[model samples]
Target: MIFSAGDGKESEPSTPLPPPYSGHNHVGDIEFHEILAGTDNFDESLVIGRGGFGKVYKGCINHGENLVVSAIKRLDPESSQGASEFWSEVQMLSRLRHCNIVSLIGYCTHEQEKILVYEYMPNGTLSDHLHKQGTPLSWFRRLNICIGAGLGLRYLHNDVGIDSGVIHRDFKSSNILLNESWESKISDFGLSKTCPTNQLSTHVNTLVKGTFGYLDPNYFRTGKLTRKSDVYAFGVVLLEVLCGKPALEELVDGEWRNLATWAQDSIKEGNLKNIIDSDIMGEISPKCLRKFVKMTERCLHDNTEQRPTMDAVVVTLKSVLALQEKLSMQAAGSRTIFGRMVDLLPFPTNGENSGRVEHNTLAPSKHGDGIVVAVKMLTSKTRQAYDKRQTKHIAELAHPNINIGGIFECRDSKHKYFNQLLFPNRGNFAEPLSWGTRLMIMIGVARGLTYLHLNKVHCDIRPSNILLDEEFNAKLEGITKTVTKETHISTWVRETMYYMAPEYFWNGDLSMKSDIYSFGVVLLESMTGRKAWVYGHIEKASLVDWASTVKSRIIYLKEIMDPRLNHNYPLQGAFECFDLVLRCIANESKDRPSSKEVLQTLERIYALNK
Candidate 1:
């Protein structure tokens, strides 16, 4: 069972696929001539990557009108593991279909030739982006990629493993490919092993396999391959992403060292700043950084028993992502921004929060109400692009559920614009909110959106754009502008894709129902305590898609409801809210309820509560 490197032993599929997949195993087999022709005779110039398996060429799947691009990984004839690894990848990837798992297009098994085709990944490997200095990934982007990869592993270890689970012995950054949309998909199942679910234990007594730096220490020492082995390797990947360093083997003091060991040593010494990538050190919030380090540390724990399961890892990473996002949007206790703002005389600077400001944020008030107003300073570039008429209109509006207060444009003596945009106390969806409170907040948000819809206001709505008060009252922000034009072009648009209606998401169409669709997603979040978008596993890509599948089944509906509710809330009320969410997120805009209707349904829910 030991499949050691350079052992001159051929690798093969660990487990034979059973019924359903047995017939389809050869579905992706392509003729050898077509692979060579598509790849221009395996042209050197067409090579996108090289590995132990052999060269991966950027090739076409079909010729003429049916042509499609693909990454054709051709196993070298000299490769000891060629036949074994080739069959494993073809078997596993052919049947697996998850958002985070890469798709296997087809394969060729000609005389003395082995080639496997995969869906072409335009953005290349995660390693290329993280360590090659190709493009610096923002903290948000890094968090997303990690979550996606983690979710993919979770599926392999948890859901997909009902009969037999997979252990990706080579789950390194280079093996993780990014599609055209920058979605991370785990690839290269050459070293994968399938274990039986009916077995009393989930370990395979086999030779250790994985990238040098990412290889699990416990597995390497004892040759006990389990799902935890993949967890250990992924910990190294997380460390690499966090530190923005490649987990390549390094030689120090005449002893070759692993990146995980080196980085973990630095972290143990409390040299966080020393290990953090200088480019993103200032970007990561203190709470987020601390939590990330803690999770990474647990993953690298030497005791195989202490290593968390992929399911736990996924959940922990999700919370970490939410923390980073919340802190970034609701940063407080910073005086540098206040120094740049031109505060009016009546609403003076208090130099401190008024204790009543929940989440350390302040809102707009009457000229001298003594509430330290939450002010955001607009950059010169953004200030230049402001739609003046829209700005004026947003500033003039007043509603209890709307957080926007006013925009002040007072210039210094030198004619420089010191623009101060004031919003009331800003906080995110509070975790402590009761089921009833969450429903009330959703109603308030619906009311706010309805008002904006009636007023012809257009804006993006998401969890971050919605603010809460001390009493859990909701207010909609992002009303004054749609900075889709000012942001990195696609960054803002990409972030809001989670809540966008299908019509607006696909085409350029935006309507009143679009806002309602977004409200539905937020309502979904409130009800289920789940994020609007989930990327780790393919089956649960978006909460809307996952929830809609079970909307008709009351038993399944109860399962998706927020666990924090303890099943203590009124079932009738929860069911009604769930139904409303389904209606709001209807695929077709015409099928979706209007903003006014959303508000009315929420009001009905609230009235029934009384």
Candidate 2:
């Protein structure tokens, strides 16, 4: 409605001032003459805003040694309501100190001129940005601002260092001032009331007095003001921020509709898409959108008891922001990256396939208990986590190197997978592995790869995909399927392009030889304790080319091995392993040795170290 005429602007002009009345500028009286001189005797051009009380002006006043640019609010003496509000504002602001709440530099009371001086807000109010079409705020920025304001409101309701809690009688967008950085500062507090903390009943039986559209209906009906009334008003502001509409809008029929009523009505029918700000329609993910909309709806709930505490609201908003950021960082065409999706895939039915987990669990238990067990569902498709002693081995397949677990389905279409959480994991250079431990891991990896290449291809292979138990028994992980068609599957699996063989890169082939190529990358990573090179647009060479091209430059034997090993590794075996890695990462799949051959070579190298 453009209710406030405040249009704040510009800097403190470098001009001589006419003795600003020798008044202190720190939370005391700013002399009336100083304000007049600072605002050029209330010039029409300097007027920034207006309220029912009076106009607000941008003033440049000399305070002590420094000149400060401030927003000067001059109250009307004739209006009896404004007179009381002026005193209320001065009382509330003098002692209160919070970052999100605006800072009051000083006030003026000279024979009737009631003026408030505040730190200059350069970006003006949140209302101006949302409804008036100035700068477009991204969903991320909006979320942060809302969180900041929520924290401020929470402090007022509980954390304030006082005997009573504060209830902001008028909590709306216009009262939210945005600084140069767009941080939200809750401004107006003339109607704020302090509810006692020690009392059994927190409500104050005060006259109902808040803005029309944002006024709590319950407060109006019974003249009972509580903290929840402020929550209801804040809910209206949340809706305004999300939908980019005014709290009250006039329809074509000339009837006014409250934003909260319309949005809550749409949300009741399980729909918020229609009213969401079109500018940020696609920016909010489905998961984040559902969470945010539901929270906003609860904030507007009619029964005060049903509404969430400001603390819960703050936490939920933060989580929503966190989820949004994670999605933004997720690599394209991949459901999971690194170990993010590790605990979601199926648990192996046999011991041979139980080495690595392929999905992250819903909640990973922090206690370190060592046992490998598969999920047994007494009910259908239940995601229940049973750890350690409660789960037992039911697998017939046996291998000392392979982790064994069983998988059973009750009556559900989708099977539940569970396995032992390996303790003291030693992959990805978690800590440097000793020479003897390295040999054990290499041998296990070779045997596992040889077994897998017998039937299917492991699309993604990296150092992180290799898991080692406390005894250094290595097991392969990140495998999605025990078997798939040799060429392609129904769903596209995104493999790490950096570890991919040239044949797989160009021809889209997941041949058994591709496993050999990826194994080569893993082996190289182990020997050097460094990652295999990924191709980039600037440097188009693959790992094979780099290895083949730079082999002569890396002539010294010690230069190639990981220095963390302290040259403790057997020279001959280390030399042989390095050569083997070069052969596996060959440019052509045909040139790469078979998994069986790689395993045999690794076993031979293992024997040399002994």
Listing every candidate in turn, what is its Cα RMSD in Å to the true structure after a full C-alpha superposition? 20.7, 20.2
TM-scores vs. true structure, each candidate:
0.54, 0.52
Using TM-score, give the best candidate's number: 1
Return the lDDT, model 2, position 251: 75
Report the error of model 1 at residue 148, Å: 0.7
Candidate 1, residue 330: Cα displacement in angstroms equals 2.0
lDDT (Cα atoms) of all candidates against the true structure: 0.68, 0.67
lDDT of 2 by residue, 112-184 (tens): 5678899889888888889886698888988988988998898888866558878888899889988889998
Candidate 1, lDDT over the whole model: 0.68
Candidate 1 Cα deviation (angstroms), residue 250? 3.2
Per-residue lDDT over 317-388 for candidate 1, one digit per residue giving the tens place of the 0 to 100 score: 889888767655544422213322424222445443222333313333222344434454343344444446
Error of 1 at 244 (Å): 1.7
Candidate 2 global CA lDDT score: 0.67
